[model samples]
Target: MSHLHRAIAFTATLLAAGLLQAGQVRVAVAANMAIPMQRIAVEFERATGHELIPALGSTGRFYSQLRGGAPFEVLLAADDEIPARLEREGLAVPGSRFTYAVGRLVLWSLDPHGVDPQGNVLKQLPRGRLAIADPRLSPYGAAAIKTLGGLGVLAAWQPAFLQGESVSQAFQFVASGNASYGFLALSQVMRDGRIPRGSGWIVPSQYHPPLNQDVVLLNGGRSSAAALAFLDYLKSEPARATLRGFGYEVVKH
Candidate 1:
């Protein structure tokens, strides 16, 4: 064989090896996590040469979709429960779930003075629509309900509530003036480690159950190297830093 032919065959073998090592990971992400996850996704791809395909929405909705056989390879949920449930249902890889971030709830308004630091605005809440996620679907929405109930305002506020299917949608309600105030994930309204240009009350953690966001590798990803690599990347320093920047609490391993 000619020397050029041997060189070409070696180059083709190397290219095939590179293709075999890279893959795509399909992930279902909670709505509140959309922004930060986008930042992490860019980093992950650059570092690992893998593509991350993310579908963002409420964790509860994702659970329903998963049960109906959605082709997602990983789930980044707003709460730990649904992921655990998926494990019990044999849909997720056992022993592959972990808490990625603990989220904080916030009562936000576009008006700079709309919400008070102590969240006292709820006491004599202005006569306008109050937005919250539907407690049936979002953990943040459930936290909002618990906060209102703890503050003795749930019953009175129900009359003026505007419910969204996910926390992101709830934030949109306030941002678009469809509602004057809304319950949202701190991450949704935060920028550069703080709430910029808006008024918000960071709901005291004691007001509701801890928002332990969990991520799990699903059965669909059991054989995907990219899926596993993404999970490991999520726990790395760069990813955790992004989570913290968005107002999430990351537990050190």
Candidate 2:
């Protein structure tokens, strides 16, 4: 074979190798999105041939990591504001941010009678433990505090509260009976709009600001094609339907 023919063959091999190596996208996601994001990642990998590496935590912690040079290509955060800030700071790719899901807070309990959907349960439980994510750090925790205040129970329930570092941990606290009851994401308690295990109350939307979960491509200046693709997939009709089925509200805008 001529020298040119051998060179062409070698280049073809290198291109194939590069394609194989580009089949993964590292993602940093909020802990509250763990379960749903796992399901979405599975489908995304199947559809796009890109493996998702998710690092889940509170939005505040993840933001710090991203700023500290964590090698992440995507962020699925618990709120839209963080993504907006990242975009404004040029840490995230502009025009790549979009709302993925609207989170809902629920009062949940492992105890059969610890929660009542139609009753003011907090007023009845004078000293019962109420688990919540730390409002100083977690967005869900902030919402929980706001909701409690809105309902006129913040001061009365302050002494009975147990705080978790992340929303997932807060839910686990209640689920394991470490606390008699707790605030959690509605999606954590419901499947197909029905609560499966212990009792829960879906707090009225009017009680707190919307929990708008957002996704954005980090400006890692790497091959974020797959990351951007997955962001688009999250807004696809089928994906939105699946999220809604899991009790997450689909963002209209």
Candidate 3:
């Protein structure tokens, strides 16, 4: 077994023996996951009596904060690399990292006919801004660039680019009609297992690298019973179901 799994097992033993008390766990979650996390947190808190305190932002920003000694106990990142880097740097528990979800990218607009199913709207886009998250900070934003590049429209759309610090903000740019369209995480626009309104084209996964969203137990949380229990709860069926409801792909445990 991985060291983290063993540790979690031991922690479970302690809990079963009534030696551990429920407490709060501070978590850093990617902005794209904020809504789903909120739902899952409600259920988790009700079931386990453990409070989850979440800080939502871009993965890159969280990495910088963690490097600067942020006191977050767990990380649910938008991409796999940051968690891997944390493990390598000893900021997180080695072997405690795992991909919790695979993110999907979408081109979305508030108008019903704003985007075509095949995303051919880019070929003759209207004269307005095209929103995207900052590629340097958001995996979804990076995927947007890759998608445009693959379609050979990067140059054509360069002048109209409008960048947001995170995918959630990019969605806002489009949702508020400040931009004609925005590249966003599927989760941002999904509801009831589908896109509830406006128009969106789900970008094919091949357009960019797989957005393997991973979660890790940070070094600071290794000794916290609540943190350990939270990690275990994340792999439960209820949590995985919540992830899927938001259009994120979850790996079978």
Candidate 4:
């Protein structure tokens, strides 16, 4: 087993023997951050003995759940505005918000040569289908819409667009061969510090507003030391490095 798995095994033993003190924190995370979050959660658990229960979905849907008292202690949203909204609505801790990463959007396809680097292929998009997250629910989706518009193809591509409930789902549609191509968070398709397989173009940031993904401590989490610890851990070098590994730009804060 890896070091972390061994540590977790030892932690379980200690827990069974009533020798370790640990706490659990519930986290609501955006779909785009799923992969990195899973790895980060494991590392955080091994390092601090805190358990993270992450629920991933669209930021808008997660926000609605939080507002309805879903019992999440923290949220890593796809956009800064939702966290700020939580603060304004007294749903989150007054000042525990900060940008954790800046997301980069990508135009990707499962076929190795499906997408051209210059993105000229997008101009003559396939008749098959193109996927994107629902613009109303996901920041990535909104960014995708903006990007298509900025490229002057939104009007032409409307009929061929397939909207997924979340960015991950949009990626899934393409990865599963249900769609010819899709726009997704760069992290979704990145592996080993590169686009491990398939064809994709890192969408220019100039095409859309900055995707300043933010995290916040919720009111339900105010009393959880584990929640506070997780927030601190998120700003640590290890966590930032993991985000970088997923092709995200960690925002120093």
Q: Rank the candidates by lDDT, best first.
A: 3, 1, 4, 2
Query: lDDT of each structure?
Result: 0.89, 0.79, 0.90, 0.88
Q: Which of the two candidates, 3 or 4, achieves a greater lDDT against the reference?
A: 3
Residue 131 lDDT, candidate 1, scale 0-100: 95
* CA-RMSD of model 2: 7.5
Which candidate model has the greater TM-score, 3 or 4? 3
Model 3, 116-161: lDDT tens digits are: 8888999885578999999999999999999999999999998999
lDDT of candidate 4? 0.88
Cα lDDT, model 2, residue 253: 45
Every model's TM-score: 0.91, 0.88, 0.96, 0.91
Q: Model 4 reaches what TM-score against the true structure?
A: 0.91
lDDT of 1 by residue, 1-253 (tens): 5432343345345434774466789999999998998898999888778899999999999999999999999999999999999999999988788899999999999999999999999999567899999899999999999999999999889999999999889988999999999999999988879998779999999999999999998999876778877777787899999899999999975
Residue 88 CA displacement from its true place in model 4, Å: 0.5
Q: What stretches of model 4 exceed 4 Å from their correct place?
A: 1-20
How many clashing residue pairs, candidate 4?
0
Model 1, residue 17: C-alpha shift (Å): 11
Residue 123, candidate 1: C-alpha displacement in angstroms: 0.8
